[model samples]
Structures are given as structure tokens and as C-alpha cells.
Target chain A: MSFFDRFFGKEKKKSAGVAKDRLMIAIAADRENSRIPNLDQMRAEIISVLEKYISIDEIEISKERKGDMDMLEIEVVVKSTG
Target chain B: MGIVFAVISGKGGVGKTTTSANLAIGTAMEGKKTVVVDFDIGQRNLDMILGLENRVVYDITHIMDGEANLSQALIKDKKNENLYFLAASQTKDKSVLERDKVKHLIDDLKENFDYIFLDSPAGIEGGFEHTIHYADNVIVVVNPEVSSIRDADRVIGLVDAKSHKAKAGETVGKFLLINRIDPELIEKNEMIATDDILDILSVTLLGKVPEDKRVIDASNTGKPVILHKESEAGKAYRRISKRLCGEDVPFEDVENAPSKGIMGKIKGLFK
Candidate 1:
């Protein structure tokens, strides 16, 4: 694109980037597994897995018991700079 | 900048606040200017532990909200002139601890204190994140139990993933302070072993505190056990403090303390 077009186009893209983006992740472990992963470890793993695609701005984690299995629900908001 | 340490645990009642109080006083006793902040928010216990509860006119929220300055809010320790205390707000608003505000407060404290100890809340939610966000080192408090060890492991992971040092691609030194260890229970193979806990957590073992009844009495009186020279738990904390200052102190023989009576001998047989 021309210099003038490129300069003016940046503002439009910046506004679009300001829009919020959210990512929800869930991990579960059942009694069949000898060892269940800790919530913090799973959180780091989730961030590393998502790091290849986007940067994380904030994270929220909670636990839910489902039958015989335990689950970790992670909600991460991607960094706007990405 | 001064070192910022967060005394944290995964579960509640694992002695995180107690450790923070003792360690801060321990460091201050060694001639380092120290300040311990109660980051438990609605559940303020550090003030009581340090026996400075009555002196708290303002809290962390007051300072963060500009209602009070850092010096104005800080309570000087009655015994140790070098030690200071910052009480947590009793307000139910747990969300008052914003990341930037927390960092600003810590940075301001670092300018004046040699060691800043953050007494983190029980869970890894709400105030817990902000408490460890600026930590240069973390003291993971655990008990010789399965649940406590598992929770401490989780906390260790969070320290690596969430701290400012971690975000900046730097490492935050992690150490474990195993507390509330019952020697009799361990001799009976009932409680988890110290070696097993260290192996599971994979963090440097700072020290082990024997489960002493004196700790309870000290807490009840709003005094740190470290002040009681006769208490084993108090002595262990003093040694831990010295170790933190890079002193070469020998670890306590918690595993092999001499048996007391017939029941103790029976417990030893199970070992």
C-alpha cells in the first residue's frame, strides 16, 4: 500500500484490536489416572499452549467436580497488543 | 531494590501468615530493615501475630487509595526497631488490590526496606495474584500432609508462571518451609516424610518447624513464637531467617528427636 494509506490504516486496525477477546479452557482428570495435575501447572501449560497463537492478558481458574473426575476450568483474556 | 518475598501456601491454615511474621522479624533481628504486609485482605492476621494489632490506624487499602501515606500507615514493631508492619484492610472489598497499585506500593516500600514480606491469602484467587506479582522470591509454607504438599506444589507453579520476574523471563527463587510437622506421627509412618515432601515439591528446603503447642499459645497472645527462646518452632524460625540471609545454618533433626515416654518408644518402633 501507499505511505498515506498505510499511515491512516493503522488507526482503524488499532481500534479493532481494542475489542476484547476471551478464551475458555477446561482440563479434567479422573480416578483412573494415578496422579492428577495441579491447577497451577495446568494453568501454565494452558498458557504455553496458547502462547503460540496469542498473548494472555489475564487468567481466571476454578475447579468443578464432575462425578468421579475433577476438572479445572480456565478462562484467559488475550492481550490486546497481540 | 530490596528483596520482595511472598510467604504463600495453597491451602488455608498451613501457617503462611505465621511464617511471614516470624521470618520478617527474624530478618529484622539480623539488622535488615524489614516490613511485612498483610495481604490477606479481609482476614487480617499478621498484625495480631506481630502483636501490633492495636497500633494499626490505617491499612494497605488506605495507603493504596491515597488516604494514608506508606510511613503513616506502617506500624513500627514494639520490640524490633528495624521491623515494620502493614495491616490488611478489614473491608470486604477484596478487589481493591489492583496490579499496578500493588506494584507501586511494593516499589515504594522497596526503596526504604531491606526486605518486604507479603503474607499472601489462602487461595490462588483475588488478592493472591497481586501479592506474588512482584515477588523476587517465594517461601512456600507446607505441612507434612498430602493435601498441603499438593497445594504447595500448585503454588510453586504459580510463582514461576505469574510473578513479575517470570514475566520478564527471570527466575524467582523458590524455597519450602515445611511447618506443623508432628514427630510422633512421622515416627509412626502416619505423616508424610520430609524427604518425600521435598522430592514431591522439588524446591529448596529452607527449614522444618516441629509442631509445637507453644506456637498456638504465642499466636493467642498476639506474639510470634520466635520470641520464645525455649520453643523449638521459634528456634527453627530464627535459623530459617539466618539461612535466608545467606548464612550457613544446619537443618534441625526433626526426624530423630529423642523419644519422650513409652508411647514415644512404640511410635519409634513403627519407624
Candidate 2:
């Protein structure tokens, strides 16, 4: 406001928006494509492993994704005790 | 754990109400008791979304004004037994709610429900301040367009300023929900992708809901798409609900994903 007022008769500040497409894209990938395997995948893997025996109740497992040190984990309750 | 989330957008019709309505239903479908309260006083469509339009005899405004108790205003869901609705007032008056009264009402609801979802009024007006003042968490909905993202940023700032946690020098647990994303448009490099939106907001990516016809149909019937069991948006909302419950949900690669906008878009348009 000071410089504009002195030089150009009170010209207002017009903010030229910084295009954030590049930054937003990376953040979205990190979030949506979280490399850390999630719980749903873990549940599917657990079910496949338990296929020989029986269904199980909420299995608790946690794992971290490799990239950007992100992590994804889930807990699922299966009906059977097997 | 009882979670309180207020869904807000700087602008209206970007699905704040839709997301609030469906997110609550999705959470209930996951076996959590959930309720969505309308704070968008004059324009109340959440009841219509939950198909409780014909059932509401009271609203949060009533509780705020001491005209009704919270229990009396809590409407049972027509579909999900665990879901509930608190309709907004049809009157344009925003003076009915006092800040402390709204907070007290929310604290009381927390004692009974696992989650309380508030559908905020469009933009950061007077009502927007009250909507975010007591939020334990906030989900800012954006449509992947410039105007929407710009408004989302403004609301995110307001959220940081007014949140109870923020007042104690902590920021609200802010997340971004991008709705009506079209994979085909992203493949054509015409629309902003998940990454693009995330980069701008610098927030935790909740989920990206693809544009689908089922969404319109679900709203028409006052039933959430998550109840459908097979629709794409329903699947996304279910995942979003689960993620909100602190479940580990995997991300499915959208058909038009791997969208790199800046480097590519700049080159294509200029070169």
C-alpha cells in the first residue's frame, strides 16, 4: 500500500494467484497412492492365507508405505475364530 | 471413539451437504452410530437426502434456542438404524444459535453418538465461524476447479483460525475431499487430478469421488449411495467412512489417474 500510494496514486494490491497445480498434484498422489499397503489389502491377504483353515475375527495388522515414509494400516473383524 | 466432523466448502452446491449426508450414512453402515446436522439454516436438503424430509418436527436451531431438547430434535434415519439427522431451519434467521449453546449441544451429542457431522453453510460467513468454532475435525470439499479450490483455501484458513484446537495453538485435523472427479477428463488432461488438488491444499487426501449418475439418483431418493453396495461413489464414500473411523483403506488407481498436470499441461499448451 505504501509504495503504490506514493508512486501511482493509491493503486491497490492485485494478487496474482500462484498456480498450485504442481504442488497439489504431488500431495494428492502421496495421499491417494499411499505406497504403504492399507488394511483392506491386508485383510484380503489374511483371508487368502486363512483360506485353508477358517474365517477369523478382526485381525490387527499395521504396515508403513515405502515412499515418503507414509504408512497405511487397518483392523478387520472376521466372524469365525479360525 | 466419538468423532465430530464438520463438512465445509467456501462455495455451495459443491456437495458439502451431499458429502455430509453420505459420510454420516457411510459411517453408520460401518457399524458406527452417526448423525449429520444441518447448519445451512435456510437451505435444508440433508433431510431430503436421508429421506427424513417428512419426519422432522424439530431442528438444531430449536436446541440452540432452547425450544427443544437435543433428543427431541434427533430424528431417526429412515434407512440405517444407526444413522440420525438434525435438519437445518428453513427460516433465514441465523441469530437463533449462540456459540456456547451450539458447543453445548455438540458436547451433549458426543455423549450419545460415535460421530456428529455438521453440514456448514456455504462460504465463511457469520454462520461459518460458528460451524468451525467447535470442530474436532473438518473435511473441506472441493470440485477440482479453480474457483472451488480458491474458496476451499479460504475456508481452510478460517478453520485454522476458529477451531478449538487451533485456539490452543493446534490446527484442526483438516482433510480434503474432491468430488465429482471425472477420470475421463483427467485422462484428457483437462481436469485437476488428486495430486494437483492435494498439492494446492497441502492437506491429507481423504478420497476422490468420481462423477457418477448414481449420486444424483441417491439424492433424489433421500438414500445414500453407500447403501447401494456396488456404485463407484458408494464405494468411495464407504472407504471415506472407514478411513474416518481410522481404518486402513487402500487406494484404487482411477482409470485416468497418474495425472501430471503442470509439466505436461504447460508443454502441450505452449509447445
Candidate 3:
């Protein structure tokens, strides 16, 4: 910490700390998502198959890591057709 | 058999070529026969860094296409007899580098040298894959910054999933070298601390090179910084080279090291 910052009481968080926090989150997401190939295409295929039966409002696809295995997760919110 | 090290950085201008040149020369000076190959293809610059541009008569592509023999393509270092270089073809298409050909070249290099350093191209496509595909080990060069660290993390994943050893159920050795460290910036909280970077990447620390003007000067003169024994960057590379050979070397405190810049001198007064 600089002398002025220490005396005046620093209010803002350090950029280095902010960078570290951002990197942690970004790297974790990259590790999980980057490993799975054609993720966007796979998500589209799943949405198409689901839309055939249900009125899909929203669909989210993500890859979650459990131990040495990767679990493909697909979450869909269905809409109520009147 | 020779150990192959791919000097890789996912981002450009992060000093992979510089590290490759220094490590090759440093190891060669240790009496180990070392060969540094430029895998950047059309953008080849390792020759310029090693001051071997004029000595290159045949390049790796020339050998791969059966136009020139390995013995002919390998340029013996003028300064260090133990050090050799294989320049990349300046005009060849990057896609022309076939997997089998690269494997053949690496296998040939393994037979002849004790150490083979492949200066990899930046990014994770085309030539980049070919560079790391045959590496027995990797030196991931990164600067203490957000983008560089993030890109290095992504490349680390590929190194594990793509390498020949990884496919063969063996693990490729991974090491991290953080370059261009400025103590003043770290003190001012403008730069990421070395330990923080190490924690994020989770790769074994090789050595931290101080941000030294001598590095740029050395490159401009086509001499690798490792030759300048007085320079801090040179000293850091020397220690890293020792570590590469399994020698126990203590890490110097880069953070507390007395700064030589004008800003550093100004900051020194406050301390």
C-alpha cells in the first residue's frame, strides 16, 4: 500500500485483486465448457428434440465436472399453451 | 533419447521465442547438446533471436518435404558447438505442416540431441497443435496479467488433452515461466503478484524474469539475454536452465529486489 493510500484510507479495491477474482471465475468456466466439443450444436439438437413435445420457454445447457467425469446438464423451462 | 520441450504461450508477444533461445543456449552451455526448432512457420523469428539468420541454409520444411536432409537442415551454433538450430520455412503455408512429418522431425531430433526446444506459435490452432502434439514437456510462458493468465489456462487444458504422451496414458510435464515482472507495478497494486498468478494457473513455477531493458537490447543485437551474465533477466534464465536439468536452485525474491528504473528510484525514497 502507498503511504497516501494508507493514511487517507483507501476505498477502492486493488486492480490485482479484482483481476484474480475475475480470472478464477473465467478459468473455471473455460475448463468446464471448453472440454466439450460442439456444445452449441448439441444444445440446439436437444432444444429441437424437446420442442417437438413441449412448449419450451427457455433452455440452458452446461457441462458440470464431477470427480474425473463430466456431466452434461440440460435445463428447460416449459411454457403453458392456452 | 532427447527430451522435447514445447515453449508455448496462447497469446502473442509473451516471449516464447526469447525463452526458447535462452533455454537452448543455457542448456547447451551446460555441455548438453541442445537444438531449438522454430515452429512458427511463416512468421519464423527464433533465427533472428539466436543470431542464426545468416547461417540458415535449410529449414525444417525443407527436410520434411524430403528436399533437404536433417543433417543439412540443422545449423550448428557458431558460439556454442553444443547448440543447434532448425529454422522454420518463411514462405511455406502453415497448413503444410503434416502430423506425420512433424513426428518424424521430432523423432530425428530426439535421436541426435540431449535437449530439443520447440518454439511454438501463439494461439491454439493449426501450427500450435503440431508444436505441442509431440512435446514431452511444455514451458508455458505467461506474463503476470489477466489475459495472458487466462489464455495460458486454456492452453494448459489442450496440452493435457492433445499431447501424444497424454493419449498414450502418460502425463506430459508442465512448467510455468512468468516473464517481464516489474516490482514497482506489483508494489503499486497495478500488476498481479507472482504468487497470485501461480495460484491461478496451478503450474509448477520455473523462474520469474525481472523486467530488464537488457532483454530488449539483447534481442535487438540478436543475442539471447542468457549470454549477458550481468542482466537480471539473464541471471533468471540461467537459474531456470539449471532447474530444467534437475539442479536445485533457490528462487530469488523478485518482489523485494531493488528496482533500477526512475520510478523505482522515486519509490525507493519513500521506503
Ranking of predictions according to lDDT: 3, 1, 2
Clash pairs, candidate 1, are: none
Q: Count the backbone clashes (under 3 Å) in each candidate.
A: 0, 13, 0
* Top candidate (TM-score): 3
Residue B101: error of model 1 in Å? Answer: 1.0
Question: Which consecutive 10 residues in model 3 chain A have the weakest lDDT in total?
Answer: A1-10
For candidate 3, give the lDDT of residue B171: 86
Give TM-score values for chain A, per-prediction: 0.43, 0.32, 0.56
Sorted into a CAPRI-style docking class, model 1 comes out as: incorrect
lDDT of 2 by residue, B1-271 (tens): 4678989998788998889988998888889999889987877888888888889998878887788998899999866799988898898577777888988888887888999899998987767878788888999999977778877876786676578878798768898989988888767556776776776777888888888799889988877787788788888888888999889998645545446557556444543
Candidate 2 overall lDDT versus native = 0.78
Over B1-271, each residue of candidate 1 has an lDDT whose tens digit, in order, gives 7899988898899999889999999999999999999998998888888888899999999977889999899999888999999999887578788888899999999999999999999979888898788999998999876567666766776676688788799989899999998887776455777776775667999999999999899999988999999999999999999998889999987766565568556544654
Comparing candidate 1 with candidate 2, which one achieves the higher DockQ? 2
**Top-down TM-score ranking:** 3, 1, 2
| Model 3: CA > 4 A from native | A1-7, A37-82, B257-271
Give lDDT tens digits, candidate 2, residues A1-82.
4442435473543221223544354444544543344545766787788756766665755555576785546565668543
**Pick by DockQ: which candidate is best?**
3
Reference-based lDDT, residue B209, model 1: 95
